[model samples]
Target: MKNYFDFILPTPVLFGPGMAERLPTELRRRGLARALVVTDRGVREAGILNPLLAGLDAAGVTCCVWDGVVSNPDADSVREGIEVAKRNRPDALVAVGGGSTLDTAKAIAGCLAAGVAEVFALREVKDPRASLPVFCLPTTSGTGSEVSYWVVITDRRTHEKVSIGDPALSPTLAVVDPLLTLSLPPRLTLWTGLDALTHAVEAFLSTAASSLSDLLVKEAITLVVKSLSCAVDVGDNLEARGDMALASLLAGAAMQHVGLGLVHAMSHQVGGFYDVHHGLANAILLPHVLKFNAPECPDKMKTLDNLVEGEGFMEWLKRLYEKYALSGEKVEIKEEDIPTMAERARANVNAQTNPRKAEVQDIMELYRKSFKVVE
Candidate 1:
């Protein structure tokens, strides 16, 4: 336990079926009229966009759609979004996709509100003022961007992910309805659940882990362990999806309170450079990284180990990927790039809080170890 700490989870959240139906009420509560709906093309095609539009329409609310977002969202895309915001100047934003959409919407809203010239500019300023309110209905159970106060915007030119975190960036309201996640394919379901698992596990082992964060982490881990497979298999099961949704929110809240460590520190670089799915990168890298950090957090590791049926938490993590059909997705890692990747990962904001301090060499080793997976 640290003598001093700062803890804040600022998002107001509602979880259940048809929560999106009440989205108009949330907007009305804030006296928001003109709204911007930020989402991707896929969500638009999935027929998800229509209901939100209908809900807003039912309340006589008008919205503009910025549906050009891409999968590994880049800073350039966010800059474009900021331009759109500049033109419409909507009073509120509704993020309606996965992590990428939510993250891009957050940066665009922040930059537009603060009148920052660049999306990256919000990163350097200590005090960020968000002018417009944000409401989110997550279509995916992972990323937790709907609840957390940080966004990862990848730079197209540099192939580096920029993490911008501030209290002003938190969504004013988050509504999660498991019905929204019913259409997710198995691959996405697997990766996102694994991502939630990694978040809880890593936050538990972080040096900043507090009594409050621990309670959430433990529950989050248990929920993921119990409900993830059912959600993936059934895809449309309400109970499983609801449990995973709650688990993801808890894990996101835990990471917000205590922060994450080596797993995310390393995965962010890989996800940025390779354009791989963020959760998949974290799942592939997690076992090796946690095993390396295990000695520094024996008791916590014991707790994690107990979550699995038998011994070896590391083995259980590896088996999880296999069980979920997540192990076969391949990411190409060049031997020459390891040095640069290691340096960047070592520079991650959360690297210092890793239970065991890691050096550049250790990051390189972890990457090399994760280059291939066996089923």
Candidate 2:
């Protein structure tokens, strides 16, 4: 037997339907009396904010809402959110929405704690000080930003999507309620599911992977393979949604230790260049990236194959994409753009952690495969 290593899940997790209703008690337990609720405008319009608001109100917590966060949250959004946090002087931050919103809240908390205005100035790994306490209520079942210590923010001036990781940014609490995700559209459900799948697969095959992380990643892969289609096809399937939530959480937990690989590295470029949805970008690139890394990690893919249905992981992924209408979605990628995107992806920090060493040629080939090739 392999020697066991220390494993820890510092963030307290609350799972199940209607679990978000307990947010008040969780915050009180942390002794946080005031909070800044950060979310996007669409989330507010979707009526997802009402339940969280009611919970905070019931807890006697004062909060100010900031709804300006956009897809691929940028430095401007972080700066504005930090300003809001300073003005409110909240004891904690509550992020309610998707990964973008959660990441925005994390940036806000980190910057406010460090007393910095430039989002890029705060070092992701160097600064040891902890950020303000953050509580996350994820409305989407992907990204796993609720539990991760990483924050992805865009530099509006340079058009670069920057990923920064620090233990300080990990949320103090994660409220994962499947009911909160019941209203997600089919397209979104598929995209986010693919992102979660990518996280699991990448982390499982990461060079830094440990036995514990491998176990979590394998479980996450199985759950995603089993439930993603049902969650997307039948939005009312609470059981499927529940499974996806668990998968996402497990994926988040896995990546916190094992990290990710090429798919995320490549997707960040798409997002930075075109402002694409993070999950959609990842979904479009997943199959091609998997194929690129297959040679280096065939054994891991074999393990994933066993989890899904034994020896055809790529085919299974393709079917899932087709089942969810994600297989035919139009992306703006062109053959000519491959060189630049590949260069950018290769430059990503996450690229270095891939178990397989990818060359520029490998990245270009992956890009060509990702290009919209209609049958």
Candidate 3:
């Protein structure tokens, strides 16, 4: 059987070492004047914001800082961010942290442009236009928010995390400078890198997978396998950092077209409910999800074996998890919570795109295996 697919790569990606140095030029190229710098308090305090501010100042671009973004960026966070952006009326937005900060910036930009305080008003259900141009500078190698069209935001009222995706929200420029990732803590480096790996693996096995996406996923998986450990162990290794960054970009590009799977669907529920880091949740669930899906997609699992190299692909992943200290400690995966989390995962958008047709029971079983609640 012949497979046909459509590919879209709209965001202009600027990748390499020190690419962040070009931020001023990129903003000016977009004809942006006043800019709102969106990021979290952590990154702001890390002193990472200094160089970016210097670049903007050197470019003579008037800018204001909004450092209130929180992890798992909730509705109220977006609303407060929008209020700030509206007051400043910045001509552009510069996102300067990880996925949470970038997602918040994307939402704030869209809401400010639409003149709505409620981000839900601009949800996939609503017809919202693109807002001020957004330029993303990702400090983490996960989530791929810099290149992806999707943004996951939690609605505080319902405690449900819904994703908003529109081509209109894609960043005008993605500055992937490996240097910024060098200071990341080891645990964060491991989690985020694993998240990037999950993106590649899921996209490769997606029912929507195409030849073009497969090419990207193949290379991405290889790079992640080879470099993730080094990047995690030696946080300051620029070469490893560069490889992971490129791997993340390729994975992001692939997911943009092929879509994700049950792992993401299930992970979203955990993130919304627990306020856990998105990458860690994805990491802990990845092996179990792979084990669940492996029976259905043996060929894809074998393809992964080429990168990780073990008696079998799943064993290879298990070994990698052990090697990275990602899988040793036993966390509780309560059988009781399976039904509820499974229901949520089943309802996620990515669930429909999973290669295996997962019934509620199938999802619950997978969740039961994946969840490790400390008890």
Whole-structure CA lDDT of model 3? 0.84
**Looking at candidate 3, what is the lDDT of residue 3?**
67
Task: Give the per-residue lDDT of model 2 (tens digit) for 186-275.
Answer: 888888888898899888888888888988888999899889989988998999999999999999998877778998998898788778
Clashes of each: 0, 0, 3
Go through the candidates in order and give each one's C-alpha lDDT. 0.85, 0.84, 0.84
Model 1 / residue 202 / CA error / Å: 0.7
**1 against 3, candidate with superior lDDT:** 1
Q: Rank the models by lDDT, top first.
A: 1, 2, 3
Better of 2 and 3 by TM-score: 3
- Backbone clash pairs for candidate 2 read none
* lDDT of candidate 1 over 142-165, digit per residue (tens): 888899889998887887888989
The list of candidate 2 runs beyond 4 A from truth reads: 1-6, 124-128, 334-337, 373-375
